[model samples]
Target: MWQNEPPVAGDLPAEQGIPTLITWNHGGNVVAVEGSWDSWTSRKMLQRSGKDHSILLVLPSGIYHYKFIVDGVQRYIPSRSSFCS
Candidate 1:
């Protein structure tokens, strides 16, 4: 359930960016996400909830590539199955 249409005026503040939720279900004691959004320089840590780890990112509309660092190892998602919109 996601909407591509532009938000109506007043729906959100002009300074706010899109709210994107990133989730990882694979097991790990520590999980983090690094993406092109920050040039892969900032590793944002995800909060663990039950069996999953997730982080909410507020980003501008654009394309980005990301990888998950689970317990100090990097994991990549193949481009063929990646979501781009």
Candidate 2:
């Protein structure tokens, strides 16, 4: 799990065995997650994306089309300009 001990590296799951989000946004006193998974995401994260905002749904699955999400939103490519750049 951990390379050493004490404080963990960031908020990311060391194992990543259980799909989840590692980061969140702090706005208006609410801790908003960056990504959403499952059906609960609409009730949490997506609603905050702003009506003027449009998310690019990229499901680059290899086969069977199985993609994991956070809160309920699809996982994004951090290297892509549409996401982070």
Largest lDDT belongs to which candidate?
1
For residues 1-85, could you state the per-residue lDDT of candidate 2 as single tens digits? Answer: 6576566577656543332222322222222233323333442332334322223333222221112244444554354312221
TM-score of candidate 2 against the unseen true structure: 0.19
lDDT of 1 by residue, 1-85 (tens): 9879998888876765678888888799899989888787899999999989999999877777888999999986564223443
For model 1, name the residue pairs that clash: none
Candidates in order, TM-scores: namely 0.74, 0.19
Model 2: residues with Cα > 4 Å off, grouped in runs: 1-21, 25-28, 34-36, 39-85
Candidate maximizing TM-score: 1
What are the candidates' C-alpha RMSDs?
Answer: 7.9, 12.4
Q: What is the lDDT of residue 24 in candidate 1?
A: 88
- Where is model 1 poorest over a 10-residue stretch in terms of lDDT? 76-85
**Whole-model lDDT values for every prediction:** 0.83, 0.32
